[model samples]
Each structure stands twice: as structure tokens, then as C-alpha cells.
Target chain A: MAGRTARSERAAGTGEVLLAVAERLFAEHGVFAVSNRQISEAAGQGNNAAVGYHFGTKTDLLRAIVRRHAERIEALREEMLERTGDSASVRDWVAVLVRPGTQHLAELGSPTWYARFGAQLMTDPVLRELMVDETFGPTIRRTLEGLNRCLPELPLPVRLERADMARNLMVHMLAERERALAEGAHTARTSWHAYATGLIDALTGLWLAPVTTDG
Target chain B: MAGRTARSERAAGTGEVLLAVAERLFAEHGVFAVSNRQISEAAGQGNNAAVGYHFGTKTDLLRAIVRRHAERIEALREEMLERTGDSASVRDWVAVLVRPGTQHLAELGSPTWYARFGAQLMTDPVLRELMVDETFGPTIRRTLEGLNRCLPELPLPVRLERADMARNLMVHMLAERERALAEGAHTARTSWHAYATGLIDALTGLWLAPVTTDG
Candidate 1:
């Protein structure tokens, strides 16, 4: 039992390092353009097969990177979800949707790459399914259910469409800000908390926006 | 005069084919992942240096692709601008920002790659600058000026922030819809016309949305 625990502990350390290195490379280059060997060498592993050994395939490596961030984000979201407790306010509900991801990035501190990395995954057709599959579950669905309760007047299709808009806004905006910070470009808001506040306000407007039903 | 016209016309024809093929390949793969050689080979040019010979560099090639789409969208926006004529209605101003690109896509028929190709460029760290430089100029600035004239009540920072949000929403959403259409996935609105209407409606709400000023 002790030996197994020791071996797994060492594996966990390597996994963390590999995930961090992979996220940075993927963020800078691209998920598809970077190879496993490059990741292994950049990770300081003498063996070229370190990435393949640690994570099975390129998709699997991508998933592992997503899972690392998603777990933390889900926890943050779950905590935010608990505070709302069926609040009917549109702002509160929208906060539930936008804040967790931004707040998690905020907590992660400066030079974060998950936003850029995730944006790349979301934009890629084949990888988008993997990202959605790995990251979304009961938490996000429940947030939507909570948000839906607040916007009952919105039709089903419009509601779904607005939800899509909100999701895109959060992902892309966060990635933009992250990129700006990395590149030393000016950001409108001073802090992530402030940035998240800005997003919640815009998204609240988006959710409550009047739908122009097609004729 | 006839000889000169024919020479220029032939050059135009090659340029058009190259831009179309590049847009398709960039949309399917990625802007950076696809090389000039691959693009040339797939474009069926016998010369391996066709992209280099014609467009000079990758950045120049990307600019040409953008220039092709931007010219048409600008023409459409110009017509829309003429009708707007400094109208103070927020919806009219917003329509100027949203409609032209969608209308151009509508005119282009099915399986269009510009939206997806543009989205990928917008998301890339380096390419996004070239995209903005090549595409945004007096036309977009004029539209924003027209939009701003109507929204004097909103704070400048919020206005700027919302404008950024609006741009992100439009680009990413259009790309997602284009991807869905290409993949034969179900899209909410049946046509690009309807999709633009939905975007205009949502953007109207976004612009008109009451700002939550950070204290």
C-alpha cells in the first residue's frame, strides 16, 4: 500500500508539471501545431515519450488539460450556485454563469493560459466536442436551469440562443483579456473581479434582451 | 487598352482562386497550421512558390483573403450607411454594424468559409492585429461614430466595453452558425437574414442595457 501510494504521488507531480507546460505551449503555438515530443522536451523530460506515457493521445492530453481547469471552475461555480438559492434576479443568475470561470482565472493569478488554451479548443471542430464533453455537466446545466427560471418570459429557442451568446462572450472575452495581460496590452478593467463585473452586466443585458422572432 | 484589361483580369482571376482556396483551408484547419506550400499544392498551382510569388508572405496572403471579404462587406456597409444618414435610433446604428457582414454571407451562397476563417484569425494572438489593420478602417469607425451619437447617455467606458462585446459576439456566433451549416448540424434560424435579425435584436438589447457602473 505504501509503495503504491508513493508511485502514484510521483506520477501526480509529473502530471501537474506536464499539464502546466502543455497549457503554455498550446496557448502560445496551437493545440494542433504542437507535438508530443516538443511538449516532452519543453517539460524538461529527457525521454521524448513522456507526454504519450503521461497522457495517452493528443486528444487525451487536451482533455487532461481541460479537466485540470474544469474541476477548479466547477467547484467555484458550485459555490456561486449555492449562494443564489433560486434568486429571480437576472443579474444574479447571469453572475452564476459568468463569474465562476473568471473568478477561477482571477484566483489563478497573472500569466494564466487556460483562457487562450480553452478558446483554441472551442474553436476547433473536433476538439470542441471534447471540451464540451469534459467540462460541462450538472453544474452548468443547473446554472442554466436557474437562469431559465428568472427569464421565463423568453421563448425556448431564444433562451437557448441567448445562452449560447453568453457562453461565447465569457469564453472569448476572458481569453482576450488573458492575451492582453500576457502581451502587456492595456485592459479596461483593473482586476479580474472588475472584469467579471463588466461581463455580468453585459451578459445580463444579453439574457434579458427582447427576442425578434423570425417571421 | 484591351490587352491591359485582359492581363489585369487574368491576374485578378488567379488572386480570386487563391483567396477562395485559402479561406476554405484556413476555415477547415487553422490559419497558422496550413502552410503556403500546402495551400499552393491544394490550389493546383504547378509552382510550389505560387503563394509566395503572388502574395509575398503568409501575412500578405492573409491580408489578401481579408481584403476580398472586407471590400464587399464595406460596400454593403456603405449602402447601409447612406440610408442611416445620421439617424439617432440605436437599432439603425446597430444594424449598420451587424447586417453588412451577414448580408454578404447570404449573397455568397452555401458552405461559405469567411466567417469561420475570420473567427480563427480573430482568436489568434498575432494574426488578429493584421486582421484589424486590414479590415477595420474609416468604415467601421464611421459606423461606431453613428452608433455613439445615439448612445450619449451611456458612459464612454461601458460603451466601449459593450462595443467590444458586441464585436466578439457577432464574429464567434456567425462562425458557429457557419460551422453548423457546413456540418449539416441544426441551426436555430433558417437563413443568414434571420440570423442577422437575431443578432441585431440581441445587440440592440446589449447596447440599450442599463449599465451597472462599478463604484
Candidate 2:
């Protein structure tokens, strides 16, 4: 048991190093522009096949990075769900979804390459399809289901439309925020939290307006 | 003078043919995936250098296609402005923005490829940056300025946020509608127009909700 634990720790350490190095390279150049050998070398592994041995392929390595970030996001979703419970309002759900993403952006050592990679992936047919199926689609399905249960009075189509609007706002803001950062803007002072809150307020108002009228 | 007019007509005919062929090729296989030779042959032109003579390079060809579509969109915007005149409601503006895009989707010869090209363009940094600077940026700036003049009650930050939401919703809907079409969904049954109207109603509701509260 002791031996297995030590080996697991070593493997995890190696994986962490590889992810850190690959994230930087992929951000600076691009997924297509970078090579596994370069990633191995940068990770300080003398073995050229280190990437394959650990992650199977360059594509797999890219998936791992996305998955790592996604896992963090998923955890936040769960936390938000638990905190808000069954009676959570539309405003509460919006805050839950938006806050974690902005907080992730604010954190130190969060990959600067993710925004560029995400933008590039948006155009990549295979990657986009895979991500839609694997990452975003499932998350969206689950989130919408939860939202629907909470907002039963709202029509499905309307809920879907609002959800789409919220998502687009989030992605657009993230992309713009990244561009601002690249252009040497001080993101620390940007007040993304307030911006997010304002967006939630706007969307919530829209969602509940009809109900208010009926009442 | 008669001879000059005839010559210009001939030039326009060939230009249209080249554009038609270029759109088909670039849509089926991405811009990088398709070649100038393929475009020439597809257009029934014998000369491989025809694309270069007409548009300079592959990137230039893409820019031309984008510009062509953008012009139509600009015309729609102008028509909407003229029809709505000085007292255009938020719903009027939203309808003007959303309706033309759906109409463009419906009218295109190969909507699938056009959509793929659009999705690619949205995420692509180089293409996105260029398109924004040359095409979308001017239109959006003009629209925002117009909106600010008309809807002075809304704060600048709020106006910008709403504008961002509207643009994102359009992009997401276009991409989703295209995907549905690519998967062999019938246009009439899909009811994208209905979807657009729903979005417009929801967004207008959101934007106007605050104003009502303030009043």
C-alpha cells in the first residue's frame, strides 16, 4: 500500500508538470503548432516519448488540460447547487454559474492560453464536436434540467432561449476579458463580479416579467 | 459608352461565377482545406490562377466572401433604420438585426457550408480580428451610437451589455440553426423565425424591464 501510494504521487507530479508546460506552449503557439517532444523537453523530461507514455497523444494531452479545468468548473457547479438547494431563484442560478468562472479567471496560475485555445477550438470542427458532446453538452443538459425544475412556470423554449443568452454573454465576456488582458489592461480593477451581477439582474428581470404581469 | 457597359456586365457575370464556386468549395472543406485550383475547376474556369486574378489569395478570397455577405447585412441594417425612422422600439431594432440573418440563412445556395464557414470565422483569431476591424466593428459601432441616441435613458454600460447579449444570441442561434440543418432538419419545420422572435421578445423584455422599474 505504501509503495503504491508513492508511485501514485510521482505519476501525479509528472502529469502536473506536463500540463503546466503544455498549457504555456499551446497558448503561445497553438495546438497544431506545438509538438509532444517540445512538451516533454519543456516539462524537463529527457524522454521524448514522455507525453505518449503519460497521456497517450498530443490530442489526449490537450483533452486532459480542458478536462482539468472542466473538473474545477464542475465542482463549483455542485457547490452552487448544494448551497442554493431546490428553491433557488433565477438570479441565484445565474450567480452560481457566473461567479465561479470569473473567480477561476482571477486565480493565479490559471492558464492564459485557455481563451485562445477556446476561441480556436470554436472553429475546429472535430474538437468542437468532441467538446460539445463531451464537456459542454452534458453540463448544459444537467444545468438546464436543474433550472427547469426550479422555474416550472417559465416555458421550456423561453428557458432555453434565456439559457442560451446567458451562455453567450459568459463566453463573450471571457473572450473580451482575455483580449483586454493581452492588450495590457488591468483585469484586477475590471469588476467582473459587478458586471456578472448586472447581467444576472437583467436576465432575471426578463424571465420573471411575464409572471409579474399575470400577478 | 455602350461597349464599356457591356464589358462591365461580362466582368460581373464572371465575378458572380467565381464567388459561387468559391463559396461551395470553402464551405465543404474549410478555407485552409480548400485550394484555389479546386475553386477554379468547380466554377468551370480552366485557369488555376483565376482565383488569384480575381481575389489575390485564399485569405483574400475569404475576405471577399465575408465582405459580400456583410454588405447585404449592411443593406438590411439601413433598410431597418429607414423603416423604423426616429422612434424605433427595442423590439424593432432586435427584429431588424435578427430577421435579416435568418433570411440570409434561408436564401443562401449552400447554407450548410456557409454556416460552417461562419462558425469557423467566429472562433478564428486572425479572421475574427480582421473581420471585426473591417466589417462588424463599423456596423456595431454605428448601431450602438444609434441606440445610445435613441435610448438615452439606459446607462452606457447597460447599453453595451445589452448589445453584447444581442450579438452573442445571434451568433449562438446561427450556429445552432446551422447544425440542425446539417443534420437534415427541414427549414420550415425548424421555425428559426419563431426562435428569433422569441429571442427578440426575451431580450427586449430584459432591456425594457429596468426602464419600467426606474420610471
Q: Top model by lDDT, which number?
A: 1
Q: Which stretches of candidate 2 lie over 4 Å from their true place?
A: A1-18, A25-53, A108-111, A137-142, A186-192, A205-215, B1-18, B21-50, B109-112, B137-139, B186-189, B209-215
- Model 2: share of real contacts kept: 0.34
Q: After superposition, how far is residue B128 of candidate 1 from its true place, in Å?
A: 1.0
Model 1 pairs whose backbones collide: none
- Looking at candidate 2, what is the lDDT of residue B149? 70
Number of colliding residue pairs in each model = 0, 0
Displacement of residue A38 (Cα, Å) in model 1 is 2.5
What clash pairs does model 2 have? none
Q: What would the per-residue lDDT of candidate 2 be over residues A65-115, giving only the tens digit for each residue?
A: 777777677776667666776777666766676776666666644336665
Model 1 gets an lDDT of 0.85
Q: Which of the CAPRI classes, incorrect, acceptable, medium or high, describes model 1?
A: medium
